[model samples]
Target: MFRTPLAAALLFATPAAAQQLTPAEITRVDAIVADALASTQVPSASIAIVRDGRIVYARAYGDQGPGMKATSADAKYQIASISKQFTAAALLLLEDEGKLSLDDKVSKWVPDITGADRITVRQLLSHTAGIQDYWPQDYDFAAMEKPVTPQQILDRWAKKPLDFEPGTAWQYSNTGYVVAGMIIEKASGMKLLDYLQKKILKPLGMQAMDQDYAVGPGFPQGTHRFALGPVRPAKPAAHGWLWAAGELAMSAGDLAKWDIARIDRKILSPEDWAAQETEVKLADGSGTRYGLGVSLGQHDGTPMVEHGGEAVGFLSENVVLPEKRFAVVALVNADFGGAPGEITQGITEIFYPPMTTQPAQTIDQARDALARKLFDQLRSGTLDRALLTEDANYYFTPQASADYRDSLAPLGEPVRFAALGKPRLRGGFVNRNYEIVYQGKRLVAITYAEPGAAGKFEQFLVQPR
Candidate 1:
């Protein structure tokens, strides 16, 4: 019933500060991947787990052949929808330059766009715009012998009716991001790739990444060569056809660096970064809970901003947990499997294994190796328990810049618990708490948190009655 989907490495979102992981600790995730590959049907996959800023685990199995050996973490991948973040980022950067606003009309850039003027940039970024996806409704899935020019693509859907009235609801429209890419091209007077490289890639030190699809004609996105992998056995894919949506190729090494950026607030400014975290309101006039290019969610109850991708013969993902200071990049050479998400989810499970009485440091160590020594001291019963004594009055997490605990109950607390001087039952992880307890040899924990209205729950460990 459970299907689907962070760590030490980078995020374009900015790298966060935390601890690192040792190679032995990193391999724990690797031990389980044989099963992940068999179940997901992925030919070959590479996964990286970064805790704080260091990559704790990375490995590859299977063939991602590009006239060579099996694909490894260093292989280049066409990360499908994940490219939307890049398209979205270019727009945000332009907005920062005052090139346009999220509320700006598309007609401002795509003259003669018919109803383009009716759509706002905000709608485009979040796929709330009413635009029809450009890939023909009966699009030739197997091949596009002829490349569709930007104008040609817009034309196919020119007379096509929108899925709905602008901003009337929420729909996953690739056309929205396609339009966004076009606007970036129109407004910047540069090819999608050139502009991205100059503005985003080069600045972010993404030297190994490129926006080319080996298929399709028209537009020379780039020629930066890297290893490519085959899906099954025949016909290799060119990167051009992916166009603006998912054409970029990068090594896991470089991708790791970018994930770090997401945590560190390096490439984008603090305000712009914060803007990326704002959730988009759904068509129902309720929030759909996604940030600009980021999706606001969680990995083991920690705040995560991430996105997934699947296009043609490969799948890719980038998941980052800001509060936890880690990110993950999982890429697979498979067109139809769910390896990316599965691989990521497995890695998360290992890194932040469900809380047990095994000791709090075990969880902390899963996230940051740098914390292991300190936690060891605590575990060895060597460190003065006095630290917890003096700090008992304060919540363990470093004081938030603002109160994240406002009026909320804590998680895992009621074997019988209290909060803010009130007798309360914390229903979920939204603000749950956990107190270490010894429960016989099993040492299992009782949980109070669930993913909730706010999308995150505070994991709590409460003392049993």
Candidate 2:
């Protein structure tokens, strides 16, 4: 899904050498979002960055489409399995209270489930329990009716089959998390949502969050969709079944607060936070991979903790780098395309840039002036595609180029880019072309065909180039 890797890469030298990122670093951060906004058809998105127990950046962009195309520092996104860390944290809080044991079997909490008699609480949090994800569409819908309750999920789904004998292997299973959420409920004698709101959300100052799925009324943005294609009335996930898999929403503002709170140990004990950071090993023990719901990896040389979310029309990622004292969160409203967790990781490299950089335009004044003039004409469509036509010398990264072609394939068309001369476009959506030109060391124009409207050749490029 990574069409192109960023030119900006972070070289983690040492924790002691780390400090807040610079202005240049911030430019890279915004550029990553800009590229995604143009390439992906996302209508709206929110991003937040927190560092050293502080919210350094919290921003939003794009229109809400049917609503207002606006960015909100207070906009809340339904962060899917990225919710697992909190789910695990909730369970651990109970463990600290002596109400449950990390090693306790699921049978103790939900005694009705026969298959879960041996799945331990820690195994559920670590996703080591052999359980199947219920939402995969392969299940017979005729037999499955209506939304399920917390206990119903354990009894109906958890009893299906283990992905492996307990702790023998690892397969991401939403079923394990449902069990963890149940443990929280039974141990606390509070509904999972109520307990989380009281202990986690409120304490962290995250007031605008909710996992509630249409309780007695309709929502302004519609209930969460289970799928995002050309499908009708996108399937809304069963409320209780969501459990710890997904269903939490919070504004970028609130998330920034929560990120700082984690650093402060405001909601979780130090020992529990340490355990959450412990690297979870793979089944065959080849790699110490996942920890609770988070992925542990390296960028340059810095250790990273991060997770992504997917629910109906929403796609998102939240990342944390304790060593760097930095974190980034991105949430998109539409979720048809691939939105990998690494996207945020990639953006982070730019937000907190390293010394050794890769770019054509450095910190220069003249280049910036030229770039602005060139982009202004191109964006306004006053210039034509003739100035920046495709050249044999210029080739995109192979994957990015291929993706462009694939997307165009739906329209069964080829776009001809900027051409030479006065910049007139030719052909239709099915067959079109353009050209890009640099006139005598000056930026010129780019002209491409307009698919639907024929005989109307748009020409925007008109510069000294």
Candidate 3:
């Protein structure tokens, strides 16, 4: 998602040498994972770290089940939505063989799907198809407890009116991917999992990965309701419910193998890789910061391509820093809140320390004043377009403006509004983060300004703390 070509090239360049973690560093990582398991009371977690195309750390902590064998590095955990990347890879491979194109209309394969004629395979891959998401809740509810075919899912969800016109906005819809998976089956003349196994998994030697339905009765089961008290077994969604969206399971070690392959560009061509990594743009020409199945962002100014997954009882996180040839994978057997993601961030800090922030007093007085004014304008729903860039204006659509006003007005004026840290340069724009507190609640605002004496706000985004 880096705006400039030079910045993108620098971030995605190949690594030079392998740097193994020191013994002390390994110990620190061990402590971090152990503490998370203890504090969160999650049953078990498997972790793997890859540096310079090699696995430097692979370990598991805690028990697999009550009084059962302890979890091992090879133990499988349902990876949920992380499976979308594999589904995406399957389609890309088909495209490479001239069997299909990402631009093909969905109606070509799934002709009955509502709005299928207008939606492209590319939009479905990037979550811009405007289809309503069938599975939005975190847990497997009553309807998911029973088996249902992919066609049933599409009939129930995709046949309805679209959430918006195709590609005008970005909204995550598992239903769209389910449609894409059907297309893969039609184009490749093979089952979805069979195609993935033959084309990608087996070639990469990822033997540990398998579809959840194919696994035998001996496979480890995850638990839910553990967050509240004692562990309770989670009821996984029926076999076909997850389909192409989130049905695969694998160990952290196996996931790391896939990460290494991605770093080396093993499976897809350079052009395909670029297409997979590039952020999809909205109709208004603003970036969605999502490419295919992965979420795109930066951590401490380092580019990151990553994804997280949640099932009835499993939670997983996978992150890769292509520039540094570093990646981290964390998988937990319990659905306790965000333990895998938190553990990934904690371990990442061991390699990349956070940037130091300047004191609030050191912030430019004019910028601070302008930020406060913009905060008020956002709450009042009366933004001054002259102070904003064209992109920023596009971002503040009527619905978005009403959303900001409705959400922020209730909090009233902020008790505190100040710069979060030193402003940084990105894409030829000065980017700054600010902390805004209303009553006792906190919110963060990120602004990108065009450089000038009277800099216009190129972007202003607000999210709750």
Candidate 4:
């Protein structure tokens, strides 16, 4: 929960402009995904780019898994949290039909819920209900393995006190969506998945959006490389528990189709569509970066509506530049190290390159390499004088090195290192920051370096974030 902020910051960097992609720029989108697959060693991925309510680019690359050949353009991959957008849409549609109202008290439908009388349907949609997240990453796995029904989920979670008073703060809560899913069933008299198929999926001709693995042709296999390692084959989302929270699987192409139709307002009225895109306000009327199920923000000066998802063995991202009528949807089969947003940003840069270019690629490479080397030495309780200037080396002397060792000893071993953002030339030196997570500690390694033959560490600091 805490770690995602860094990645989100990197993905939403402001660009100078936004425009339509030319034919050559569209080709570069494919190249970006291809390079990502080759460099990261990701098994397979499906990518689709849409423009002006049309599918401009949709292709799959690499193998589906160990034995399968390259994935097909239509091969389904779990869309993860992107499913939330549709769930939110369905609820809004119900409101349009006079079946329910966003201002209606949730207790009206689920009376026994602890704070249902105080929370509104709009609060749940916007994650301001203060409901605790149901499947926190650290939750016990044994409980998740056992199937659960919506009523069982409500009985288990709805009676607890909210994390805070409704509309007071914003915290992403999968449980809120799970509760929303139940409300859809109670108000509409249809299963959440079946209602979506009849109301949204079939209407859009999105055949690839399967509710669960047991039905349809099933999802392409996915593998997790960290923690749990290789998981069992991917399947449809279970009926209960994760149902409305995150349980839809579809191809990148199909996901793109949904986004295209959304821009065209094909399923819902214009007012309802606008509500889905509007950011929710807290008790003080401060805007949350999130709106309903989708996030609302600007990328490179261009307003954007987007969402990303990560499940057992899949990672997906969907970005829509509504003003430009451009969207990019990427679905990957591997977990742990995939960068769907980075791939999406690379595509965005092609269509809307940054206004001012920065340092040469070589400078960034040098900074990253030197930063890694310094941190490696620091973790080992030593400092490499050769990598620093005489004045810089004096700052991290032997005594200081010993102190660093003593202070950081309890943090345990370093487990992961990742760039926080691109290296940039600032004050005549290249500045960069990297996230280094220890077994129990997380820190940002801030570094400054001078490039060329005399390039060496000008400044270095590593401490708790």
lDDT, candidate 2, 171-223, per-residue tens: 56677787778778889999877888888888776764455452222221312
What is the C-alpha lDDT profile of model 3 across 126-206, one tens digit per residue? 988889777654445456768888899999999988877889877777898899889999999998888988988788887
Residue 116 in model 2: lDDT: 64
Winner on lDDT (2 vs 3): 3
lDDT score of model 1? 0.53
> What is the RMSD, in Å, between candidate 2 and the native fold over all Cα?
15.9
Candidate 2 overall lDDT versus native: 0.55
TM-scores for candidates 1 onward, in order? 0.65, 0.66, 0.73, 0.71
lDDT-based ranking: 3, 4, 2, 1
* Top of the candidates by TM-score: 3
- Considering only N, C-alpha and C atoms within 3 Å, which residue pairs clash in candidate 3? none
Tens-place lDDT digits, model 4, residues 1-465: 011222322332222113345768756765687666544445667788888777777766655653333346777777777899889999999999999998999999877777999999999889888776655441123355567876787777666777788998887777888889989999999988889999998888887544346233334566543221122344323445467887688878788878888778778888988999988889898888889899998877788999988776677999998788888888877553445876887887777776754443332555566687787677667677888754457557565566566655556667877777666443234567777787655666666666563588766666443
Would you list the C-alpha lDDT of every candidate in the order shown?
0.53, 0.55, 0.76, 0.70
lDDT score, residue 127, model 2? Answer: 66
Candidate 4 or 3, higher TM-score: 3
Evaluate model 2: give its TM-score: 0.66
